[model samples]
Target: MVAGGGMGPDDEGISFAHALATLKEQGSALLVVGSVPEELFAKASRTMLGDPDADPPRRRLVVTPEPNPESAVRRLRETGPLSAEYARVISRGERARSAAVADSFDEMTPRTHVVDDSIRGLGTTIADVIEEFDLFAGGLEPAEFRMAFDCLPTVLATHGREVAFRFLHVVIAQARSVSGLVHFRLPRAVDSEAVGLFEPLFDATVELQVDGDDLHQRWHFRDRDITSDWLPVGDRP
Candidate 1:
């Protein structure tokens, strides 16, 4: 039985269509297919020939298989049988590593493990991590969440907003991942709306609602829409 795989996600899969396309790329070609189903032999003898065993008038019969176990084994044992003529493939393994490998190929993109570790190591509560990384929501104590939150900025800085946010959808463990509307309350008085705004790559919906003596506005990322529960941006501001 056919088991396992050997195709990458980018390659899609091995199919007759892809094989044909590869041939066309090389130039002129002709594909010949043959199968020895019982019905064809009977039909050819009766319809084309006046007699059951008679040969057809304008046709040549080139029997590909002699109806024997040896031929079947020979036909099936294909590793690179037609490598020069019609390229044959044995197996393909599929994996979701294309985006990651391609992204980091030129040293431009970060690795998958780097991203995964970044999120998981975020010092937030274990509950928060289980929520984000594990994609499950649970009650975590304040101290633990604070522990997890400590790693937020470093994680964001290293990962960047693009991949960071996509992963944060699971790693954030709170409303912040999607529509939770969270940010750092910059104590220095920057727009709270501007917390995760270092790069426009991340579609952060947080809006800063800075108010009086909020000179400490730079300390936390305030939600412009609400004046309550504004979290610290980097455990600092």
Candidate 2:
């Protein structure tokens, strides 16, 4: 899982493109959960669909509670990986109203599900979250899917920590049953005691820190070796 402290501006530089690329190449389903949907899209664009000339995944599903899909497409086109290509694609599809259509490139567009929280008579309960996953991932092979839970803190805030924990427990089970990769992001600013509850849920923990032009990342494989390295932002790995 790609967990970050998100304590400062530098913390935003954390990159999980490598992980996403690996999972996609393995043909896995992906679940990305985040408070800010745009950031999630940008991450996917940079890593999973970074190669402007490469093909899009067969089933890249993105579910969000946000309303403006067009803004998401704009974010990807302006700042995501292959920004120039995304921009060109948007230019060509200027009249398209949906992000899936506007963001489509090289003939591949991810399936996007937008759950507007502002809608009347809508429920933002934990069950609603799980239901969305089921709708997108039901019957899909775990090995063929990779999911990202961008930030659980938001869920925790909406529903009590206990409820959020139970929800994740169920989600993780489904992911493991399908052998799909599950990546989660949690802010470091959360209570240390509460954060401990997530440790056993994840196999490994990764930390990313930005120092000047260099991005430093450390991986702690529980009960295994720890690896740390630095990468220059402008230089490709």
Candidate 3:
């Protein structure tokens, strides 16, 4: 079931903060589909990770395709301070591509797990890494963990739609089992048609766009046939 919060429709629109709070409170899988700036993507990632100072303190996992380990760490640092124990990264296929990436992972606080792109093995490796994080949480509630799958388009292209779908199905199931909030990023520019194919796998889908200098986002919640108006993405409440 979808997590409930003060996200009900109002005369204006669904409050972005309220919508996000709902997802964070309960474990849910979300798909973010759009073509927007990298900075905006970072903002959405930060939102999924939630406040670092939260009472229970959320653990974060970022699955990225970035080949440069330093660059990936930098981007994550932009989200907030990195706690080696609470934050982790699954560097997909980057370890084999660069020696530097492999060595860097060994020396990072937000420990990194490097895995190859084999379609058959990728899902297992990711699930294993998440399980490691879950164990580290010491049997805390699922809401204590958050994950960001930052390379949906790359995975789709590398494994094809059918294979990618299967992989996502497994990952989403893992998320639900642990009640962890997980989100996959899909840039519509890569394959717009793929959105519909994958939307059913997620509890909700967030559509983002840019209009001149402003950025806006609309959320389509699956459990409830509710869609929020395009509201400007602003500072977190």
Candidate 4:
């Protein structure tokens, strides 16, 4: 893309040509971040298509690239671990954040919400949160981790509230397992009504579990870790 942008020769800067050549030798990703304006092209050639018009006759272009990422995630979650490809993609939080976020809708899905927002964004879901606690007696740290939804929220009350508990449960599951902090970075779409409900209540509740003490705690809801208001509690000063 750099060379294609026509980096000048006398500028002594490597053009997209050299960059592309080097990239071919050492395989790596070429991410074009944010967004770019759409370009128009003809079927004449691949490299040099039509120089897109500044403002062309805006005709319709029906191109079926693929279903939106949400559909793809729905299929992946439905398939479960059998959907290793999708899980693998999930494990790679960077590429998959967008997909996970889009599926943040509660009625539609919760598993993907746990995997993407709860796991990747908050840096929870893995036993590695505390950096030294290890289960499996391996002490090898968590190989890979995420909040896999064996079930959904029984009662969400509202969309935001559902998403909140959804986020909290995943962290509680992982935190109680080994050693880790429940870091809550609320999703942009967190139900506003539910936001205050939990936030003001439990933001200060945090501690380290040593010697499997969590196993004895009497938790409310699904498990003891189920918090009515984790983000608010965790976010307290």
Off by over 4 Å in 4: 1-160, 187-193, 200-237
**Per-residue alpha-carbon lDDT of candidate 1 for residues 115-149, written as tens digits (9 for 90 to 100):** 22434433233323234422221432221111111
TM-scores, in order shown? 0.23, 0.50, 0.81, 0.23
1 against 3, candidate with superior lDDT: 3
Q: Which candidate leads in TM-score?
A: 3
Error of 4 at 145 (Å): 11
- What are the per-residue Cα lDDT tens digits for candidate 3 across 37-145? 8888777667666675676666677888875555456545655546666776777665435654445555444566667777656677677766876787776585677
What is the C-alpha lDDT profile of model 4 across 65-181, one tens digit per residue? 122334323333333332221131223334455655665554444233223333334344333322322322243222122222211121232234657565555545544343221
**Against the unseen true structure, what C-alpha lDDT does each candidate score?**
0.25, 0.40, 0.71, 0.27
Model 2 has an lDDT value of 0.40
Candidate 1 whole-model C-alpha lDDT, 0 to 1: 0.25
CA lDDT, candidate 3, residue 54:
71
Q: For candidate 3, report its TM-score.
A: 0.81
Better of 2 and 3 by TM-score: 3
Supply the global lDDT for candidate 3.
0.71
Angstrom error at residue 182, model 1: 9.1
What pairs collide in candidate 4?
Answer: 3-16, 160-191, 199-232, 202-233, 203-232, 203-233, 203-234, 204-233, 219-224
Evaluation by TM-score, superior candidate among 2 and 4: 2
List where candidate 1 sits over 4 angstroms from the true fold: 1-117, 120-148, 174-189, 192-237
Question: Which regions in candidate 3 have their CA more than 4 angstroms from the true location?
Answer: 1-22, 69-71, 78-81, 94-109, 189-191, 235-237
